[model samples]
Every structure is written in C-alpha cells, then in structure tokens.
Target: MTAPTDTPSATPSTPPDLDLAVLHHLRGDLEGAEAGYRAVLAASPDNATALNNLGFAAAQSGRFDEAVELYERSLAIEDGATARLNLGNVRAALGDLEGGIAELSRATELAPGDPTAYDNLGQLLMLQGRIAEAEAAWRHALAIEDGPRLRTALATAVAATGRLGEAAGLLHQALTLDPQFGAAWAQLGAVLLLRGDVASAGEALANAKRLDPDDPGPRRHLALALLSLGRTDEAVVEFGELVRLAPDDATSRVDLAVLHLSAGRAAAALTQLDRALEAGPDDDRARLHRAFALRELGRLAEADELLQAIADGDGEQADRARQALVDEAS
Candidate 1:
C-alpha cells in the first residue's frame, strides 16, 4: 500500500502566492492581483521575479510610478529583461520619451525572444514616425511563432507603411486561422479603402462592427471610408456616433473638425478644436488645427499668436507648421 502524504505546510511559501497573483491578473482582478503580489513579497522579500511581476500588474492598473519603483527594486536584485521592459513602459507613459526609448532599445538584446519587447519597441518607433523600422520590428515579432494573437499586430505595421494590400491579405490569413479576429476585419476595411475599393471596405468594416459593437475604432474608420466614397450623410452620422463614444479622442475629434472645415463650417470646426484642445493641451497638432480654424474665421490675431509659438520651436511638430507661420508672417 502506498503511504499517504500530508499536505504541504504554508510557512514561508511564496510561489503559491505568486501563482495566485498571476491568475488574478489574468482574470482581470486588479485588487486581487495587488493583494496576492504583496503577499508574495511579504514571504519572499527579495524575490526578483515576484517583484517584476508585481510591477507589471501595477503598471496595468495605471499606478505607473509605483510600477517603476518596483521594477527598479527587482532589477537591482537581478538584471531581468522583463523588469526593464516594464520600467521602459512606465517611463514612456510618464512622458520621458528618450528614457523610455533607451530602456526598450536595450531590452531585446538582454532577451532576444521577448515578444513584448519587440512590440513595445515597434510601437515607440511608430510614435516617432520611423515607419520602416517599426515594420521590421513588428515583422520580427510575427516570425517568433505562429501564436494565437500576433496577426493583427503584423497587419497593423504592414498597413502603416502604405502597404494596405498586404495588411488585407494578412488579415484574411488571420481570419482563416482564427475567425474571431474582430480587429483584423476592421483593419482589412482600412486596407480596402486605400486600395480604392469602397464596397469591399464596407463589407469588411461591417463585419468588424458585428464582432465588436462596443469598440470605437472600426466605426470611426468606417465613417472615414464612407466620406471618402462620397456618402456624406452616412459619414456624418458615423462621426457623430464616434464623438459620442470617445468624447476625448483627439485624433477622431480633429478628423471630424477637418471634415467640417472642408465643408465651410468654421463654427463647427472651432467647436471640435475646442474639445481637442481641452483633451490634448500640449498636442502641437491640435494647436495647429486651432490656428487654422482661427485663420478661416478671420481671427488673424489669434492665429498669429498660436503660429508664432509654433515658429519659436516650443516643440517642432512638423516642417509645415513652421513654414506656414513663416510664410504668413512674411
């Protein structure tokens, strides 16, 4: 007969707590995740893995500064790749762009196969307008493995570089592998629009909306496609829905304002810029839009004030803003 074994005692046990914390995080329970991670820390004070994982949970919950401190503590104990990635992400969120870039720039070298590091680097590069480099990094992520969730990412990078047709092809391939890929269908619609095929774009965009009715990205893009195809009334209604859903989305707000401005609705454009400025005060793009709106409304003084700031190198958004200001002044 086999001897019966007693259950393991709980004294000094931390792996159990760490496992539980990860489980809670996966289940989307932030409060439970925090409690479990803290419990693990109580038992294993210098456990670098537990500390780094704890920092990831904190960052996901939007406690960015606390996350950075935890990641730093963990790194001091053990120079881990994951901890560095988490630290870089926190720095990115805190507006320390160069610092964030530097840390992420080093993460892949420390752990070459880290998908998160590649994705983060790709996103940061996209933000910097280095589309070619971003595409390469995102492609590297796709080559790692035919995982369950990487196709949409690859398609995004492909599309960003004006290769929408390739993105559409990948989205189709993704759906063939996983029909539940809602974002893929939506992005496929964007690709179709760039290919100048509005009918197909509508179908793809409709499929995306069917899969995820609550998301705003598909609907907003569908609206743009509609406008591009000369369906003005439908576009207007779609834009209205977008504004209702994401009142603080400055990009969508600016797009809406541009549509109105193009149609000679200066007052409506001003209202959109008002909302954009309120949501993104430091956004040079929104400020430029506001200046454009002011100029259209014959408010040259207000326009000049904003334009002068852009020319003074408050923060260089693009060459056009600086040139526009110079041209107007001369």
Candidate 2:
C-alpha cells in the first residue's frame, strides 16, 4: 500500500489543532484524526490541508466514496498537488481509471518535480493497456528519481512492446541497484526465456523462486526453462509443484499433460488433459494433446475422431491435427 502523504496545510498560519490532527493521522489514529480535522474545519471551512488529511483518514478506513468527496472539496478550496494525488488514487481504487489518470496528470503538472505523481500516472496507464504512454510516464518519473521500482516498472512496459533486449538491460540495471528485488529477477528470467537463453533464464528464475517461495510465476517459468533444457524429469517435478500451487490453472495442467505425453505416460497425460478440458472445455491444446494420448494408448478410432474435429478448426492446433491425420493415413 502506498503511504498517503497528508501534508500540512500550505496556509501561512498553521493552526495547532490542524498540526495535532496531522500527527494523529501519522500515528494511524483515524478516529482522533477525523475528530481533530473536523474541529479545524469547524473554525476554518476552507482549510485545504485539514480536508485532505480527513480524506486520507476516510480512505484508510475504506470509505473511498467519502474520501473522493472530501478530496474534491479540498481541491475546490485550494488546488494543491497533495489533494489531487490522493483523489487520483482514491478514484483508481473506485475503478474510475480515466478519472484517476486525469487527476494524477494534473498532480504531476502541479508538482512537476514530484516523482510519485508520475509513477502513479504510469501505473493507471498500464492498467488501461496504454503501454507506450505508460513507458513514457515511467521514463519521466525515472528521470526525476532513478530507483529500482521505477526501473522495473519501465522494463515491464518496454517488454510488452517487444523490446526484449532493452527490457533485459533495464532489469539488469534494477538488479544492480537492488539485488534483493525478486520481481526484477523474475522479470529478467522471463525476458531471457523469451530470448531462448534457457540456462540463464532457469538460473534467474531459481533465484526468484528462492527469494519468494510462494510466488507461482517463477516456478512456472522455471518449469518451462527446464523443459526447454531437455531436463524432462526436473521439468515434471517443477510442473507437479506448480499444479499443487495452482490447481485450477488449465494452462499448467495442459503443460503437465504435454510432459506426460512426451514421457510416454499416455494414461497420466490423458488424466491431466481431462482435468484441463474440464477446467476449460474450449481449450484446443488440451483436446489436441488428448488425441495424441489416445493414439498412444492404442485407442486409434477415438483418436482419429478427435483429430478430425480439431483438423476442421482454424489455428495452429488445427494445422497440427491435419498433419497428424495425414501421418496416420500414410
């Protein structure tokens, strides 16, 4: 959770009550903070800092709607960057991505030197799938304050645009700045895997897995890396662990099924494929692999029927199915 910056009112005359309220807010005493802020507001309704702090307390209490109202009131009283930033975050939490972006953009303009506004704007843009704009925002933030978190964020947007080499360099820079950043290590592993540097990818992913044992992402990528390295037994073990971690993931089940089929364990492959299909009935990969498993088990008639259906479809799986049919006939 990003900490809220309940800045003191920029007014020349700072009231002691308002100062105490800020202290209460910092101490996590939302009730005391609210009472103190309200007391200040009673004396000076136009106290923008008090209003902003009250909004922060409301947000901490999960009263986002109230926080939005208070932030808007604070902005109307005095157009401060702090209120705009808080309002932007609250609006994003309320699922108003465009509103959040607008407020954060304004906050950035109001405080051009503040990196937090740019970082937040980048995040909202990323959520909206505007990758180029997100990268630009993060780049601006990085220019203001070069940090590992910002670099990692920029690398993510960079990678999304197919600039894998540039993304890898950014990740390396972030790791150098903070080697303990598991997310950067995981992202570096993914980029390396995409570049077909499976050995390096596996090593990075293993480090990520060791650092964050509960994260399934590193485990999943590590399994794929091991599979690409032709360490089938190790891949199977990792995939098995992945299955345990995310049982409802049809893609992981299909991957495990593929590994089973490659190892000539047709029965085991069929079981995993069945589960995959159950989880995602429209999964063409599971159905295609199931046909191969059936064929391996000498269920040629069922296999041909399944393959014919898939062959009539339009996709990579369909092309593979058509080729399988030709092979069977030949």
Candidate 3:
C-alpha cells in the first residue's frame, strides 16, 4: 500500500500540536505524530486536518482499520478532498474495490483540478481490471497536469490493452519529459521485451539499472532479455544478483538452476534446485529439475524413483514426468 501523505489545509489556523504532528509524520516518526495528533484532537475534537493527518500516520504504521476510522471521522467533520483520497486508498488496500472507487470518484469531484486524485483513481481502476476507465482517468490527469509519472501510468494502461508500440512511444515521451525517470526507462525496457526486441530491451534496462541501482526490476528484466538473446553466461550472472537481492525468491533460484543445467553444471544445478525447494517445497518444476540433475550425476535409481513418484501424481507435472521416464527407458 502506498503511504498516505499529509495535507493539512482544512484547518484555518494550525494548532502547535497539529503542526508538530505533521512534522513528525513527514519525518517518519509515526508514534510521535500519532501522539501530537491525539493531543490536537483532545483540544479540538472537530479538527478535520488533524484527523486526516493522524489517519495518514496510522496508515503508514499499517493500522489500516484505525486509519479508515480516522479518515471517515475527518470526512464526517469536513468534506475534504485529501481525506476522501486517503480513505479511497486505504479502502483499496483493504480489498474494498467498489468502496475505494466510490471514495476516489468523490475525491475527483471535490477537487476537479487535482491531477493526483485522477492518477490515484486510475491506479485503483487498473487494479480492478477496468483498463478503459483507467486509461481515461490517466488521460484526464495528463490533460490537467503533464508529468513523467502520469505519462508513464497512462502508458501502462495503454499497454494493458495490447498497444505495445503506443505504450513504448508514450514511455519515450515520459523519458523526454524527465530523462532521470528510472521507472520510465524500466517500463520502456519491459515493453521492448514484449515486442521481442531483446537488444533494445537490454539497452533500455541497462540505462534503468544505471539510473536506479537499488531497483531489482530492471536487473530481472535484463536477465530475461539476455537469456532470450542466448547470452546464458551473462544471464546467469544477472540471475545470481537477483538471488542475492531477494534470497527468498524461489523462482529466481529455479531459473538459475535451469541455466546451470543447460551449461552442464549438474552440481551447481543441484545446489540451486535444493535452495529453491527449501524456499518453495511445493514447486514441482524444481523437483523435476532436481531429478534431472541427479540423472546427470549418474544417480539413475534416485532419478527414476523421483520420476515415477511425480508421474503417479494427478498434476500438470505428471505428463512431463512420464515423458522423462519414457526417455530414460529408451
């Protein structure tokens, strides 16, 4: 869930405690902020801004129920646009999609000129699979205020509708608007990869990585692009980095194992497959790959037993396991 930002404008004169609460919230001291907000509320029970800011602090602290209650009280006290927006986002985080849409829609109506409201509403719509509505909302946001983030969001909505080329163009425009936008570069790379332009995708992903070294998304896509381009060694290196960044990611470990098996490194493959199984014991693919690695190590009996067990199961992996058994017998 995106952390809610404080918008303390409803109160005509901010009390000292309210001001201190907002400062604490901005500084990430949720406890201090909550205390200050409660103090303000004690003094002025009808302070809508204090209520909203307290809700923001609560949401940041993962107290969604409290945040929703505070936001609802704030809105009841005063129909503030920021309160409505925060309520919408918190409702979305709580999986109340319809309720979130209603609140967000109300926020847009209350603040027609606010681009952020439209953008946020568009994101919730996209999450609900209402792509057309999302696209329209994003377009509305762009019309009100042009920015790289909104443009990129619009591009994502466009891409969801299968317009990859147009999405790429929009992402390019977003980059032009703000060349330092790492997210745009990463998104451009993802769209290029979907278009089967591995080389260009690699270049774009590289740029994204350069811009945001701490972001794992660009590196993950870059690894896939490299693998698709037959740069297996480089792909393995990138996958290693991904594993390092997200040690609990079984999928990356399985992927790295597959590459190791392809490169005839059965020992390495087995090691990765073991780690993958530890992370996700239900991963049939990792189990099957482990059997393959055992076969490569000349442990035929163990491999055969694993294949037979998998073939007996009523799962999608059964057919592949049966085929492996047949191939082994031949």
Candidate 4:
C-alpha cells in the first residue's frame, strides 16, 4: 500500500498565512487549501511550508506530478521532514518504489523521533517485499507511539514473514484499541483463515463486513471461510454477491463456478465459467473447470476436446485434466 500523504500541522513557527492554509487542509478542503497555500507563496515565494502544504493538497487531489514538483521545490527552498515525507508518498503513488523508499528514509533521518515518518517508511518497505526491514521500521514506530494504525501495519509485516500467530495478536490488540476498526478485523480474519480456523475467521470477517459493508476484503474472506466450514450454499451466496459487486473479476467468477459445481448446479457453473473464460481466455483453471462443467452437462465431445488440449499442456492443470480423462475411461 502507498503511504498516506502528510498533512502537516501548523506550529507557532508557521507564518499567519500558512496557518490559514493548514486549517483549510484540516477541513478537507483541498481546493481551498491549495488556493490559500498559493496565496502564501505569492507573497513569500520561498515559503517551504506553503510549498509543502500545496504539494499535499495536490497529492490528495490525485495530481501526483504537480505534487512531486511542489515537494521538490519545497525541499530545494528548505530541507524538512514534511517535504521529504510528502515527496515519498507522491513518488510511491507514481510507482517509483525505490525513490519513495529513499525519500521516506530521508524523512526519518530529518525527524529521527517522528513515528509517522517511520510508519510511512515501513509501509514502503513492506510493499517492496522487505518484510524484515519493514518489521523493524514498524517496531520503531510502535516504540515511539503505539497507535492502532501502526499496530495493523506491523501485523501485516509480521504476517508476510509467516508469523501468523504473532500477527493475529497484534491485530487483536489493534481491535481492542478501536473495535470499530474494520481493517484490523479484516486482517485478523485473514490471519485466522491462514491458521485454518474457519469458525473464528468467519466471525471476524462478518464483524469486519458489518463495520464496513462496502469493503470487498472482508466479503472475500468470509466467502472462503464459509466454504472451508462446508457451508457450500452460504459460500455460493457470498460468491454470487461478490460476482455482482465485481463483474469483471475473473477469479471471483471462477470461485463462484466451483461452488455451483459442488452444488451439482452444472448449468449455473457453466454460465459463470463461460464469463470467467471470456474475461480471461488463457486462464488454465477456468478452462479446466469449464471442461468439467461441460462433461457434467453431457457435452462429452466438447469436454473431451478441451480436456485433451489441457492435458497436452505442461502445467499443473494438465494433471487434473488427465485425471478426469482417466476417470471417464474407468
């Protein structure tokens, strides 16, 4: 995940004009904040705070290139932790992961005790798959300030390292701090799923879904948990809803098809597999599943042809196709 942009607070050292800009930013008025920051810069062209804040406003508005330029300008005028952090976030948003890491590390150096900077650095490190470094950075941030968000981030890094039990403990702590934290609940649910604790995973995911109904993360995990518990009917309903929510999601379509097939609903499975294949024509799993659905529907010729083609391939799916052919012969 890209690190969130910084919204620097106004300190006593802030100029009067820049203070107004900070207020506008805090009020979620990006346009007003940008205009106010521009006004401050117009009067005092070298105001690092104005430039940095404007960069933040631009970044929030999705104008990443402009945000980067503004942040660079701010850094040129006066090197500061805020400018470096904002620049790092913008660079990460732009897909420059290495550049983002460098800027965030510089931000940490500029503000050695700033937990936010360390948290941002940790996020970038995690994105880069540097789990050990990410864990260290998150631990540093937690040492400075044990916030719920930081704990969740740390849990993610720990989970990536396969310390799922420890990760679950961290997410549990995060939820205790803020029970309404849907993300923490969702993370805990995922960790439980990894541990094969389907019952607990389902409960946690349901809580996450209740807290944030619009989030697809909890819904996906909840569906998987239901499937693991042998509640294929309930899993089918959840997967159906997921397909509706994300029509173009080939993976969900395939998952729904599998549940339908398990329920002996070959026709319904065929429909979903057809759509999945249309969305991802070269998907071996979709083709393999489609062949099974076709065979179940008594379209033996079509099924045999597809299975033969799949069996000829040197992929994992080929073994399944070959097994199906053997079962048919028997």
lDDT of 1 by residue, 1-330 (tens): 001011111225547777777778767787888788788789888988778877877777788899889989998998867777777778888878677767777887798887777778777777777778777777776777664346777777788878877888888898888887887888888888888898889889989988998789889889888887788778877787788898988888888887788888888888988998898888787788788889999999998888778767657665657888878869
Writing each residue's lDDT as its tens digit, candidate 2 over 139-220 gives 9999999988889999999999999999999999999999999999999999999988999999999999989988889999
TM-score computed on alpha carbons, candidate 4:
0.91
Q: Sort by lDDT, best first: what order?
A: 2, 4, 3, 1
Answer with 3 or 4, whichever has the higher lDDT: 4
What clash count does candidate 1 reach?
0
- What are the candidates' C-alpha RMSDs? 9.1, 3.7, 1.8, 2.2
**Please, what is the whole-model Cα lDDT of each candidate in the order they appear?**
0.78, 0.90, 0.89, 0.89
- Look at candidate 3 and tell me the lDDT of residue 302: 92
Name the better of 1 and 3 by TM-score: 3
Per-residue lDDT tens digits of candidate 3, residues 1-330?
Answer: 234433544354787778778888777788888898899899889888988988887877789999999999999989988999999988999999899989989999999999878888998899889999999999999999998988899999999999999999999999999999999999999999999998999999989989987688898999999989989999999899888888888888999999999999999999999999998887889889999999999999999898898889986788999999998789
TM-score ranking from best to worst? 3, 4, 2, 1
Name the runs in model 4 displaced over 4 angstroms: 2-5, 8-16
Instruction: Tell me the lDDT of candidate 1.
Output: 0.78
Q: In candidate 2, which residue ranges exceed 4 Å CA deviation?
A: 1-45, 57-63, 291-330
Whole-model alpha-carbon lDDT for candidate 3: 0.89
